[model samples]
Target: MNTRILKSCLLGAMLVLGGCASGLTGETYSRDEARAPQTVRMGTVESVRLVQIEGTKTNIGTGAGAVVGGVAGSSIGGGRGSIITGVLGAVAGGMAGAAAEEGITRNQGIEITVREDGGQTRAYVQEVDPNMSFAPGERVRVLTVNGTSRVSK
Candidate 1:
């Protein structure tokens, strides 16, 4: 009974955390970006560097962790001891959960520096796409929509 509830809560938390992540690849676009016009510029890749994209920090992760921790901790003891352990568990769980959520959603990205045809140089960072690779001297397209830009072959 208690185990079932715990499992359900954990599953729910996982689902919520998973739903929070969205695609950050060059080929991915948000719903609002669909049917929108983008400005395109031709550029030559000046450099490419690997980077890490940070994950989100949200109350959902912390709250869910706290709940799970509290439940698990409260089950450990009785009376006041249970309450104390529950509180401590909630605190520890919250921190662990937040970190877990962030780590799970973090992405590998690339910082692509490009020299535009207009003689302007800029760097754009996007989640690394397994299907596309960029080299320093390769020609690419810089597409900008609503001030957000991505580099693609």
Candidate 2:
């Protein structure tokens, strides 16, 4: 019974840990809203700034790490010492796992400023693409929908 439970827990942890890693890049999309018909605005690229997109922490790392750490720490000693080590190991593992998830999932982004067809200007920040480079004064199409936007040539 104990062995089966341990195996199941480890499997679950591994799956959740996998989710902590980042997915595909290139095109940018909003996480808070669904896709709608985008409104396009013709513009010229005014500026582009390099930036970092922070990763999310959903506790999968902490939970997976605690489970794995406790399992490993259980083999240390016999009584009080074993219990203390297991607890400490679990706590340390959780923190390390969370950091690992953050490091893995963090993204590189760019903040692009555009001068629209009219006198108005707007700025958008999105994930950077190696294939897409926006030069100052270059023409672009600003597509926006549901409070999210992207700039493309």
Candidate 3:
């Protein structure tokens, strides 16, 4: 009876965990509002100024969490505890890897000032592809990137 109950509980827990990690969160944004051009090749950096340095630091919390959880779990019953702990470790490791990758990347933005020929003046790089070629003294058209923003010229 106890074994049966344990099995059922484990199965239920597995199902619940699976559902949570399946990206079931209902969140959607319209393409018009979230779509941006994929790339920009000819735009020049208008106003070359370092806005701010953004840094992503890799955190070993996930892996560390997994290792600790595994060790603790392994010390439990003998077989059952070990199995449960291993699964928990795996999940922790996955989370840690994802966080590390996210933290390792960095992005910096610059305000671009564009000047077209014949005195046509317009600025569109700020928040968009401010880094796109504007020459502070040149001209360009920028495009968006998957919703972020980028140069189009």
Candidate 4:
């Protein structure tokens, strides 16, 4: 492959991998969640802790990376040597791509420990929303739908 074509392929793969990330913030909802009924409970935040939200794992990232790597590696030598390097590149690229996808999509989150009005204590974890901030003793609402829960002011 030409150098220009190789660069373009790599760039396209990166874009595809980046686009696979989805929002996990309290204010963000999946299409299935829209207009759905949710159980709402009133609570007071007892504590707030910072946390890390792991990224998604999908075949798209690994496959894209492998293709890019295989092409790059195949360009390294002639004939049989190219084949060997291509295979090795695909394996290494797959692993690297998975890690890159995770790192790229990883998010900062919060663990909110709340005391419900009904006297039940629970903790909710969600990706941090830039527009929202939680502090100890703040009033909050715990909303749950289809067993997924979120905390909001």
How well is each residue in 61-122 modelled by candidate 1, as lDDT tens digits? 89999988888888888999999998998998899889979987999999999999999999
Q: Which prediction has the highest lDDT against the true structure? A: 1
In order of appearance, the predictions have TM-scores of: 0.97, 0.78, 0.33, 0.94
- Model 4 CA deviation exceeding 4 Å by range: none
lDDT of each: 0.92, 0.76, 0.43, 0.87
Give the TM-score ranking, best first. Answer: 1, 4, 2, 3
Question: In model 4, what are the clashing residue pairs, if there are any?
Answer: none
lDDT tens per residue, model 2, 24-135: 3336554644457778889998998999988767688777778767766665787998898789878877887687667667889888899999878988877788988898
* Prediction 2 TM-score vs. true: 0.78
Q: State each candidate's clash count.
A: 0, 0, 13, 0
Best by TM-score: 1
Q: Which consecutive 10 residues in model 4 have the weakest lDDT in total?
A: 1-10
**Candidate 3 residue lDDT tens string, 55-142:** 3333343444344444444555667766887677557654754454344333344555444344543344232242333345444554
- The lDDT, on a scale of 0 to 1, for candidate 4 is 0.87
Q: What is the lDDT of residue 125 in candidate 3?
A: 26
Candidate 4 residue lDDT tens string, 1-153: 457766987898889977887888888889899899999999999999999998878887788778778777788888899999989988888777778778888899999999999999999899999899999999999999888999988
For TM-score, candidate 3 versus 4, the one ahead is 4
Worst lDDT run of 10 residues, candidate 3, spans: 20-29
Q: Which ten residues in a row have the lowest lDDT in candidate 1?
A: 1-10
